[model samples]
Target: MTIELSVLVEEADRFLDAARIQDYCPNGLQVQGRPQVRRIVSGVTASQALLDAAVAAEADAVLVHHGYFWKGENPCVVGMKQRRLKTLLGHDISLLAYHLPLDLHPEVGNNVQLGRQLGLTIEGPLEPGNPRSIVLVGAPAEPMAPADFARHVGAVLGREPLLVEGDRPIRRIAWCTGGAQGYIDQAIAAGVDAYLTGEVSEQTVHSARENGITFIAAGHHATERYGVQALGRYLAERFGIEHQFIDCPNPA
Candidate 1:
């Protein structure tokens, strides 16, 4: 069964609760396209490559974790931005993006998915009081040595995660998907033995060592691929629409 673009957009917006937060870019329907959507494509970003791939796939709509018009980005749609928008417009492909919402979703979110893949049971958010906190705290279902856990992350993510092991076993772990090294402090405050995120900055190394918390810099694209993929699969199964994930690699 096929669903209208409007209907799918509404469903995705409702699932992500896009109206609840002030995001960097428009959370839903960044670009308008055909009314009916039979094939849906998903990707990490709405770059030229991804948009071209979606167009090539004859996708009616493209869903993504990153989209055009970031919060602090220039509003003018020029240069690369213009090309990206042009591709979507020329193809009549609707663009739907979910940023923070995708990261924070309880069941299918990146953080939760990563934790589940690593056999971790989430205890709570890393931030004490923020219900929408991006950082999360959890414990392994069974204790694993720090090196072993690192190996597990590497194996599942298909990339060797950068490991900064502290002199402690990894029982309590904290994580935030996608370049959230700034949350290292929050993880430390949560009393977690280790903190994991997609990308790490230079200061993150020093901070981890000083704070006595182990840190792992998994690839940003690698870590975040799960949430959007899970969401697309869920939409496919529930709504009976064709869904495909277009992988555009980003090392950082």
Candidate 2:
């Protein structure tokens, strides 16, 4: 079945509530292509490799978690940006991206999906007041030692997580998918025993040690792959469209 590009964009925007929030980039269509989309390709980031894969698959549209035109990013579409956009436009492939919305969506969100994989039952948002707070608090299906929990995360995520274990067992955990190391303090404030995110900074180690909260730095790309994949599956089921998730490796 074929769906118009506009229709797909509308559905995605509605699913993500793109217009309601202040986001870093345009949430819906970043680049326009053919009017109708037949084969949809989903990926974590709209990097050149993902675009190349989409082109190789002869995809009509590329749905991604990270797209071009990020805040604080260079506006000039020259060099890599120009090459990427030109390739997509020249091949008539549309680009649809979702950032925070993908992270916070209750069902198919990154944080939610990661928690589920790790056997965590979501309690609430880590940041109490912010609806768009990416950090989430959850309790394990059963309490596990911090080291054991870290190992579980490593096993599920296909990468050894950097563990900064505290004395407490891990019953309540706070997580923010992707490079949200800065949210460790917020997680601590929420009184979570451990905090998990995709990447870690030098300060994160010190913060975790000083604050007495366990910290785990799972691979960024590994942790985030689930949400977009789940969203893609949903779209496929809902729209009866062909969807494929293209994985491009990023160690960080």
Candidate 3:
């Protein structure tokens, strides 16, 4: 089955509620392609490798969590950027990306999906009464020691997460996927026993140590691989089109 590029884009944007959220980059349809799409390829990021794979797979559209043109990126289309855009334009493949919206989604969201994978029962947002709060608070099925929880995360994500052990077992925890170490303080304030995110800074260790909160830095790429796949499945089921998720694995 095939659907119009514009229709697919519109449905995706509406489904994610992309317009209402403020994000670092545009949320949908970063590149224009052919009038119609029969196959869509989804990935965690739209790296050159993923794009190449999409092209090889004969995908009409590439859907990803990370796309081009961030808020502070250089506007010039030269070097790497030139090649990426050229590849898309040359093959007439559309680019559909969602950042915060994908994370904030209730059903197929990264956070919610991550929690589900790790057997965490979601409580609520870390910040009460804030619609834009990406940090979510949850609890594991059973209270686990920091080391045990870290091992579980490693097994699930297939990457050994960096763990900063705390004094107490993790009862309540907070998390936001993909480079959200900055939310530790907010999680701490939320009175969670642990905090988890992708990519940890030097200071994150100190915060966890002093505050007695277990911390886990799961790999950014590993933690975020699910949301885009879930979104792709949803789109495929809705529009009766083919969808494939290609993982161009990144150790980071």
Clash totals for all candidate models = 1, 0, 0
lDDT of 1 by residue, 1-252 (tens): 689888888988898787896767788888999999889899988888998899889999999998877767788978988898889888889998899889988878888888888778888787658868888888887777778989999998889999988878888999998989888987887788999999999999998899777899998898999888888988888789999998987777
Compared with the true structure, the alpha-carbon lDDT of candidate 3 equals 0.95
Best-performing candidate as measured by TM-score: 3
Which residue pairs collide in model 2, if any?
Answer: none
Candidate with more favorable, higher lDDT: 2 or 3: 3
lDDT of 2 at 108: 91
Model 2 error, position 174 (Å): 0.5
**How accurate locally is residue 36 in candidate 3, as Cα lDDT from 0 to 100?**
94
lDDT of 2 by residue, 1-252 (tens): 888888888888898787887888878899999998889999999999999999999999999999988879879989999999998999999999998889889899999998889888988787678887778898988888999998889899889989998878888988998999999888888788999999999999999999888999998899999989998888888888999999998888
Better of 1 and 2 by TM-score: 2
lDDT of each: 0.87, 0.90, 0.95
C-alpha lDDT of candidate 2 relative to the true structure: 0.90
TM-score per model over all chains = 0.96, 0.97, 0.99
Off by over 4 Å in 2: none
Off by over 4 Å in 3: none
